[model samples]
Target: VLESFGSRGQDLSTEELWQKVLQEVTAEELRAPLHRLCALQAGWWLADRRLGSITSLFCLLRQAEDTGRARCSQGENKLLYLLKAWQVPAEEASLPLVQSAEDLKETLCTSAAFLQGLLELEAENFPTAFSLLKEAAGGFCSKRVLAQIYTCLGCCAQRMGKPQTALQHLKQALQVDFQCLPALSHAAAVYHELRETDAELQALALLYEALEKNPPGATSSNPRFLMQTELLVCTPVLASLLRDRHPSEVKYLLAQRCLQDGRVADAVEHYLDVLTLLQEGPQQQVPLVGSSALPRIPEVFLEAASALEQAGRHQDAITVCEEVISRTTDLIPRMLRVEEELELPECPSPGEGLAGLSQKKENLRCLAWRAAGYLHQGWARAVLGESKEAITQFSRCLGDLLRVQLCGSGVGLTENPLPEVEVLQKIRLLSLIGRGTQFLELGKHKEALLDFQHGLQISPGDPAAISYLVLALWKLDRKKEAAAHWLKISQSPPREDEQVGRSFPLYLMSCLQQAVFPHRESLSSRLQDYL
Candidate 1:
């Protein structure tokens, strides 16, 4: 009788429940019901990122598992689960319980072999591990063997600048074991190299699954393990997104805390900002570890789209939707389309008023990803046009996203892969202001004005929020009153980056085209200079 709690591999946070499952597991319970969480190295060698020697740390854990470091299976299982949650998928994952001492040793050896190679490669000893893993793959070894084989090869190819080829091997690794750390790692790298950022983000979620805990206790005779966290997950590439840089680390840590506190949307925005900082190309104004091979351009594009869509910028949403659709023939395009449609005026409020049940039903295929796609599209659309469509798109995108954000998924779709305090703040601000912006675009000026006002309260001195308030008031025939708010934005710039700065140029250009605002050459020069 295994004494673990909850429903076996159905969840991740099962520490306490696993402790109870040691009572004794039945023969029937030895099959697919047994879920294991193994640890993959969170930190490893790359361009310029380090996390407390995470590679070596995982190696240490492997040693402990092999050498009988823990007396009881409970301790071993807990440690194993933590490791797996961290993204290391073991070959022995689906194996039955060890009935005898030798059986235990056999399992330990199998786990060790895979983990050893993982650590070696992560530690930058690719040549050494590759030779060994290759030798093992020749025999009828575990899927882990094949996973390591192809993944390592893919990584090598990626570093050598053969992205298309690297993608092939990486995909094979994933085929062998979707949750395999090496496979996921290489796949993420390859996707970024190929500019298939949507794929990269999805693969990244698998990395996070390794760290998640299974909830709900399982029924078992022996309480060897617990399954308190019912949300069984794939894995997450946590450390890959963060480097040793202080700002990056801080941002990621902040995002983690926010996620743990049940603020996922906020966390998503934080990471997006961080990703922007990370994606600023090699010649960034702020020095953060931005990689040449990183899919920063696509990632930033997606993040902006999401932010704008959430803020209800229909035109911005359309722009991102087009870009995403144009770039890939993958499922994301279909998903973004659903969001684009939902942004339409006749779609009704989030909870009621729409007759698009069939459309929503169709989107149910991959609601989470679809919701995420819409999130990106809305933000992008907001940037290209007036607030109306963008606002609607942003609202619908978020509504769909929140509707299916799996309780504790800790999901984020942003340029900044790491979430921090600033990211979370931005998320909240964006969510509120995005909704407000939608109202403004829809000609519900009073409603938009109120929403903007509320957003400003949350972010007291946010220049963007102030600008939004001004826009809302102006649309509501309160142009004279809105001037005071513009004073705030002119004096203090919130986001002065190219993306944020584009808003300034765009607004001026719009005014110039329509002759709505007055400004001769000298005045315009002053305006340009001030901006």
Candidate 2:
């Protein structure tokens, strides 16, 4: 019975062993067997986050004590003491029964100190908690418990404003038990407070890996009190830790870091993982820390497409753009007027107050989202040398942008323009430049000239627009005007060579390959000498 219930219990299913305990273990056998049973069950329950089950077991052990049939063993007593200490403040609960044996006295004293330290930690008494944990640290305990002790020590140090010392203790916790995740989480927080973006990213990446390695529900065979994560650390202090974020959110953060650091390929892979997780739908079981950290789903798709474009995966970029387009296209209204948006009903009328305002805002977002999709898809097609198809996409983008009309006297477009107006105007400029370049590619110089001049009116003195406009004039035999325009751009002091290289926009790059500009050097070089 001891072998089945105690030593080899983990090999059997929890339910199978539990059933055996119910059927075969007798009243006379209950004392020693009950200690083993509570010890084993406490570990499983704590690890599984089934704290209610542990409470029931605690009550059952208490009943055995009342009957004088069970002398709770030292390990069981320590487990109960820790669990009781973790509760929020009330009148102090009775301490677990201590054995009278001389050798066990020191061990029980150390365990008492650990429990006191936890209570002090919970009450935000950092100095007291730090002192008690230090006293407990010198005594013998299981490595996992020692890891928890170190983690608490780290937490106390952080509260005491000794972040570097806190980090040292957190590192020690990980060394004691490499799977100690609370230490990793606290370290990440410390790194964040220090403004160590790269270190924080590394720490968050490690924490994420540890979490994925042991999904919370996976029952482990070693059922020694698996310290509940919440119990092991203070909630309010390390509340901003990335551990609270869903794994997908963490991936999104990591991807943003990689992209910022110029690791485009790595960013692309991480973004793909995020998109896959999102497509599987929200994981209701895992609490998302906050949705504020994530971009909206369509925005994330657009970011991924941009990253893919930067990585030179033009076809993949186009496909992602298509995904955004297909999803949001139906949501966009056929036309949007700024006047209707501004005049949303102030008083509640059947479907008309906040709901009406929200629907209008959503429609505006959908319009912007679909227009962005066409812009990206058109740019990708231009990159792939598909001039006619690219022109079609660019025209479609312009058609969407043109639907947003500025109407009504109090629109305040000049002083406080609506978001949709800003988005529409920006996209309109890009779409015009894009289609104009495509027009240049097909030798339609007059049409290309009109598009470039119109884009210049929207964003006057835009370097790319000026450059394309010059090219269009040069193509149309207006040499003196083209040279004058080129000279105006050259008068601005040159930026860094890398900046100059990138200053030429993506849409205009296709214009460089046009048959009209066939020369020994690139268009920028041709423009330099054209005067």
Q: Judged by TM-score, which candidate is best?
A: 2
The lDDT, on a scale of 0 to 1, for candidate 1 is 0.44
lDDT tens readout by residue for model 1, 1-531: 232433453353333333334223334334223223112112111112232243344444444334444333452333233333232223354556533223222333333333444455566675654543443344333564456556656765565567887788778877886545546655665676676656765665555444232111211233232211011111222224221122333343333333333344665565555555555554332333454223223333444444344444446545654554344324322322223122236546776644554444334433433333444444455556646655665566545444332122232222222122123223345555666766755677888777677666655755556656766665666655666555645566445432342221110111112212222344335335444
lDDT of each: 0.44, 0.67
Each prediction's TM-score against the native? 0.29, 0.58
Candidate 1, residue 189: Cα displacement in angstroms equals 4.7
- Candidate 1 segments exceeding 4 Å error: 1-119, 122-124, 130-151, 156-189, 194-431, 434-447, 460-464, 475-481, 491-494, 497-531
lDDT of 1 at 418: 19
The positional error of residue 107 in candidate 2, measured at the CA in angstroms, is 18
Clashes per candidate, residues 3 or more apart or on different chains: 109, 0
